[model samples]
Target: MREIDTTRVLCSLAELEVTGGRGFAVGEGDWPLRGFVVKTASGVAAYVNLCPHAGHPLNFRPHRFLTSDGNLILCHSHGALFARDSGLCIAGPCAGQSLTAVAIEVVAGYVLLGADVDVERLANDPL
Candidate 1:
């Protein structure tokens, strides 16, 4: 089995099966790197929790980032719909904008933040 890195683990693959997505945070204090991971058709994708339309966290409820049908990422604040894989805003006020992608990979049945990502930088300058 591959050695697991507990520090970087966001959520288990099994956990995503229930909700289709999961929110996570990295770092500490004032502003940790808040993000979410979603299961995509191709594999999985991660993005900053901040929505481009109103700069609000996409979900109003915990881990509820998908539409009712589990098709796209829904911004609860303003009804923005984004592509699950690419984070592109396909509908709503911010049509041409996209969510800030976070680097992540699944290994040993767990999702982990990519090694090169700077948590502090991302949390501070989410755009």
Candidate 2:
């Protein structure tokens, strides 16, 4: 399991001021990856930085993933609108395609991602 150094606690889940705002970028998994953890009044959501449109990072500018209204996750490369709740582009070039979600759990305001995610094992394993 990859160790997470979350000393820079951005904000507590209860202290999230806005909906669909950006969170910390903790390293996870086997490969080098940067994940954006989104926050809302209801709960939190996490997604890989990769965009489904053209295999590019979603955030063009630093810590600016959502639109001005803060309703959807916007791909700056092509202006794709992804729902914050579902992470699916409801309208855009990559419509119907959803962002790959990484499971996360909020513990005492710190978010912990699934570092040792066995993707291949899960795929090969039958229900």
Candidate 3:
């Protein structure tokens, strides 16, 4: 695995699920920026863990963010399925809605938070 600058690193791209998903957290204190990263054909995509339909964390099990077949993002809370690359909810209570995407970049085989993002603010915002 490649060593990344920890201040911005989320995970090593190699550690991310190739046909599934992996959960991650950034910052500190009560409201760290919780999210997940999914491996996609074009590269990687990430989103806030909060589900749009219920404002709940999408996974009930750790790092279990993708559907069994590994084609979509699954919210274990209520079966909401989202497109892996776009984070758009295609079915379920929040149909036509979308997951809140966290800006991420792949660098030196590491997934990282975009430099311009405010971690504390994004972590605390209810939206």
CA lDDT, candidate 1, residue 7: 92
The 0-to-1 C-alpha lDDT of every candidate, in the order given, reads: 0.95, 0.67, 0.86
- lDDT value for model 2: 0.67
Candidate 1: how many backbone clashes? Answer: 0
Task: Report the Cα lDDT for residue 115, model 3.
Answer: 82
Please estimate how well model 3 matches the true structure, expressed as its whole-model Cα lDDT.
0.86
- Candidate 3: C-alpha RMSD after superposition: 2.2
| lDDT (10s digit) by residue, model 3, range 3-122 | 666798888877875546778889888789999889887999889899989899999888888888888999898999999999999999999999988898888888888889787887
**Ten contiguous residues with the weakest lDDT in model 3:** 13-22
Q: What 10-residue stretch in candidate 1 is worst by lDDT?
A: 1-10
Best candidate (score: lDDT) = 1
Candidate achieving the largest TM-score: 1
Error of 2 at 4 (Å): 10
Q: What is the lDDT of residue 93 in candidate 3?
A: 95
Summarize candidate 1's per-residue lDDT along 30-105 as a digit string, tens digits. Answer: 7899999999999899999999988999998889999999999999999999999999999999998999999998
TM-score of each: 0.98, 0.72, 0.92
What is the C-alpha local distance difference test score of candidate 1?
Answer: 0.95
